[model samples]
Target: MTAHLPASGTPGADLGAAVRALPKVLLHDHLDGGLRPATVVDLAAQTGHVLPTTDPEALGRWFVESAASGSLERYLETFAHTVGVLQTADALRRVAREAVLDLAADGVVHAEERYAPEQHQRGGLSLQEVVDAVRGGLDEGMAQARSAGDDIRVTQVLCAMRQGDRADEVAALALANRDAGVVAFDLAGPEEGFPPSRHASAFRTLRDASFPVTVHAGEAAGLASIGDAVHRAGALRLGHGVRIADDVHVGPGGEVRLGRLAHWVRDRRLALEVCPSSNVQTGAARSVAEHPVTMLLRLGFEVTVSTDNRLQSGTSPSRELELLVREAGWTHDDLVAVTVAAARHAFLQEDERRALVDRIVRPAVSPGTARPGRHRA
Candidate 1:
């Protein structure tokens, strides 16, 4: 079932309002990237760690400015502060719990928050202990949301830093907790030198066990990295697969030429977890208006919008959709379709996915409502 929106002729105010009200799914948010500045300040104070600022707004601005340094290395430095405060079980639980509640407030019905367990071991907690802490927090957060009448489901994606040698260990951890709210395994961190093939053993293990996988590709690197992730790592989704746009050519009369790899990705209906704001901050795209998301959608690619790092990028799922609409002239229908695509590709059981599609995505995109802009072939 697919929901359709009215044409772009609808009033801009109505369009934005409807997009915000639409139930959304987020699959690429990071647990560390969504921390509230006040939470960071409080945690730092409790842990006796010095912060650049105790003021919440200033700290938030510091994170945005630090992440905007135009280099992945600098962008990563911001996480050092965030992870510094997340070294203990209590801290982890607090961050995870608040993250879910925040997503719920943004009208996200489903979300997969990823983080590296290896990063949280500074206080001597084992990998499983870190996982347990986050799980407890998410469970509590979900319960709290339900009691508050906000229906939200959250899952964890255990990420192994590509620069580290713990991919295999992380894969094992994910499999061990498959039934404990751990939904998928991912390879994150610097994507330039640390190719997905470096973690071949981990990918193979996940593949053999049929564990879902998504690799951070096409953001720091280009199509070659995306190719390796798809062919070698068996990635079912491409995290920030923005650079796949490099393979697409806009010909005369608005026709598009898709390279073989791009064609295969689109044809197979593999999800592209595109984060617009983060892409611009990381220089993946020049601007939201210039993002290839519109092109990919027009070309029939399975694209899902996400907030890669809310605090770091200063964005939310609603804000991202709003940016696309205002900057790229997108409509509510487009937002609904993208949200539905995300839910469809979520790392949930088959029956659960179908139920969400029927109950959420379908109703959100019903035809004669404002339809999304059509792409030129």
Candidate 2:
């Protein structure tokens, strides 16, 4: 079902307020990609990691500008500084804690933040230590959020860099920590050369263990990569799967047809973690208005909006939804639909997903209470 706001005229300020008040579910946030600008400066100073600028605001702007280079490869190069300072357990904990708090403040009720654990070993810490530290930070952030009257649940999706040869080791790490805090496994990093098939053993391990797996597919690559992710790697979800639109054709008669792969994804309801701003920055789409997410959503794909890299995109879930409302003509209904879809497809068990929708999402977006601008909670 779709929802709509008043059609005549709505101020942007009012629209932004309603979007912020709606409870959000985030499935594609990146821990290392969403660090606070000031925190990055402080951590860089402590670790002696040189940055483009020492000033927090300038560093933040530099990240946005560098990531907006319109090439995914160049966009990813901005991560070196973030990964550079995040080599210590203490650094990971601080970043994780801040990520939860920041998401909660942005009105996210449930979130799955991911990071590549193998990337944090420069400080001589074990993979287990990295997971432990991040889990500790998530716990700490949740506790603090509760004290402040914010209800939020954050968990980890451990990722193995597809370009690296440690997929097997990282898969083992995810399985070992599954019961503790890790909820799923992921294959991340460049997708052009390092296809999901390269991590076949890791996916096998995860599938045998019945652990959830999401792959960074259909972003920098095309249909073949996404095909490999779903068919070969057994991915349950696609990270930045916007490129799946390549398989969808819209005719001049206003009719739409889906290619076999697109049909498979939509028919099976494989969630697409579409981050509009990040997609635009990386040249996946021209802009939010032109992003395939809106079309895919209308076409009945289980589309979910997210802030892939909050810092790099300079976005929040609320902001992403607002962009759709203003640019792509999304209404409150579209916002709520994506939120519920995210909750439904989250890595948690079925009962937990239901509870998240009922206790968090439904109450905020319910009719008569979710009107624009006036529904601040």
Candidate 3:
């Protein structure tokens, strides 16, 4: 994380210093979203699952190239290879354990990794068994990080596919594991025809239980879907809430106008989990430079950057921040504000969240400290 001080008056120059060292808080990440290509190939071979390619590097490139089809549906086909290999308890545990270590290595202080338990049950394991396997893996990963003196905390977010009718069951699964490291609930999967309102019963149950929820909205769908997630599903945060920009307009002479939906999102301060590369791959946006994340940040919306799927999109949180700095001209203050906003809005206990802000974010931004540099293991 070598900090490169930007020349005077350069766009994003200040951000290079701040974003590099900032103790990031990640609220939206998928467990199956990130996988080492070699691990995938090995796990596939171990599980006897046939793969499109046996070579690790070729298989990795295949994922990135195949995902360039410019549609979320097409991008998701690459997951068959990953999910196919992650069926057994041992496989699930290894994946989960490695996921935590990877995030820690990437400098994530706290992360919430979501996955659908229902999807991993094809190997004759019950939903509880699946959760236990993942949890055990996470626990082992945490122990390893602690041994290495890396301060990283991880929580699980149980996702129920909006296209399925098992939302209530998934909600119950989350609640069942609430004290066992599960922090929240989510609804993921194709968002076009599957409006979040379809899962109202499950949302109602979670709300009644006083649990936090985030919905994958405004990505494949539009503002109406985001509206349903917040109004009907009670989402505390939004996953890839990029399309909310559809409601924002910029006029001549730098004047900006916000439609009803955009204004509400800004005013409510709901965290928007913006993933730049993933958005481009899914055709949600034209390119990283054209991403609305900058607009939303300038408009005072709570925006937290993320890598929706590292393997598929070929990105990391640091890389995402760097791309925004290079393309969008974000500064150190902007970077600090966004990272702090993510930490502030993380779905963790109040005291734990505060401790992270004070111990990590504050020091990383202090003027006398060394400039942000790459993580050297």
TM-scores of the models, in the order given = 0.94, 0.95, 0.93
Off by over 4 Å in 1: 1-6, 9-11, 14-16, 364-377
Distance from true location, Cα of 363 in model 2, Å: 2.2
lDDT, candidate 3, equals 0.83
Q: Pick the candidate with the highest lDDT.
A: 2
Model 1 TM-score on a 0 to 1 scale: 0.94
List model 1 lDDT by residue over 1-377, tens digit each: 12333458433444555555567899999999999999999999999988899999999999988888777778888898999999999999999999999988777888999999999999999999999999999999999988877788999999999999999999999999999999999999999999999999999999999999999999989999999999999999999998899999888898879999999899999899999988888888889999989989978999999999999998898889888877887866687678779989999998999988887667745533321211113
For candidate 3, the per-residue lDDT at 109 reads 77
Our tally of clashes for model 3 stands at 6
How would you order the candidates by lDDT, starting with the best? Answer: 2, 1, 3
Going through the candidates in the order shown, the clash numbers are 9, 0, 6
lDDT, candidate 1, equals: 0.88
Query: What TM-score does model 2 achieve against the real structure?
Result: 0.95
- Per-residue lDDT of candidate 3, residues 1-377 (tens digit): 44543432464445544454556777777888688899998998888888889898998888988987899999988889888888889988998899888877666778888899999988998999999999999989988987776677888999999889999999999999999999999999999999989988899999999999999998988989999998999998999999999898888887889999888888988999888889999899988888888888888899988888888877777778778777777666666777788888888888877877887876776432442233435
